[model samples]
Target: MKQTPNVIVIEDNDDDFEALKFAFEEDGAPGLDIERCTTGPEAEHALDRLRDRAEISREDRVLIILDLRLPGLSGFDLLKTMRHDSRLRRIPVVILSSSSNQSDAIESYTAGANAYIRKPRNFDEYVDMVGSFRTFWTGCAELPVLG
Candidate 1:
């Protein structure tokens, strides 16, 4: 497992993104490097850059929190692209969506998402969720060493 992986958040909603940022700060997420991407293209570019640099610098281990809906390309589409790209395929992608649809969850898993997490209804729950995620992903779990 890698020491600490960078986190890439692909979300379009301003409020949700703010809440996630606050949660990260409040929970004292350890060793987390966050990169925000509001659009699919932006995320793709970010991923490309990350992959390129990782290949050269041996910096691997990336986690992506993606929303289902977006202005341009959808999160599912991005997931597919990542899965198809060998440089990006191993990065853990967790779908953080407001939709609790079974089909959506199935589709995300089918598209090669590492996990599917439904967005909490309120800020408190969001904070709790963040805490749990940090505790597990950052503190306990042995993340993949993409390098």
Candidate 2:
């Protein structure tokens, strides 16, 4: 059976989170289990919670959509932590940020981010981006099982 993937969105801005959520819903993503974390610390806590879940196995799917700039810990720090932890390193991290800087993208990629995507300026663009995201992550990509 195909396991449903859990999407962990690490975005601090309320409006941006809502916009992304709306885009996901509009994109016809079924069985979309989303977890929103306002800060990097909150996201770390959430991921740790999932890690401790007895029902969660290594075969379970998980995808982390992270923002570069956060209130508490920066995205780079979080990514580094995840990469070092054996239990979390397998999970693919996708960087979604408003920053369009080459350094940010290069740094994200260098830090083991699977993908770096810039946040869209408008709702239409966001919808399209989300659509592509859904298609790639859910439809095309083979995700690692969360244990």
Residue pairs with colliding backbones in model 1 are none
Instruction: Summarize candidate 1's per-residue lDDT along 1-147 as a digit string, tens digits.
Output: 437778899999999999998999888876688889999889889878977866776646778899999878899999999999887787889999999789999999999998899998888998999999877776687777666
> In model 1, which regions exceed 4 Å deviation?
none
Best by lDDT: 2
Ten residues in a row with the worst lDDT in model 1?
Answer: 53-62
Q: Show model 2 residue runs off by greater than 4 Å.
A: 54-56
TM-scores for the candidates: 0.93, 0.93
**What Cα-based lDDT does every candidate model obtain?**
0.87, 0.88
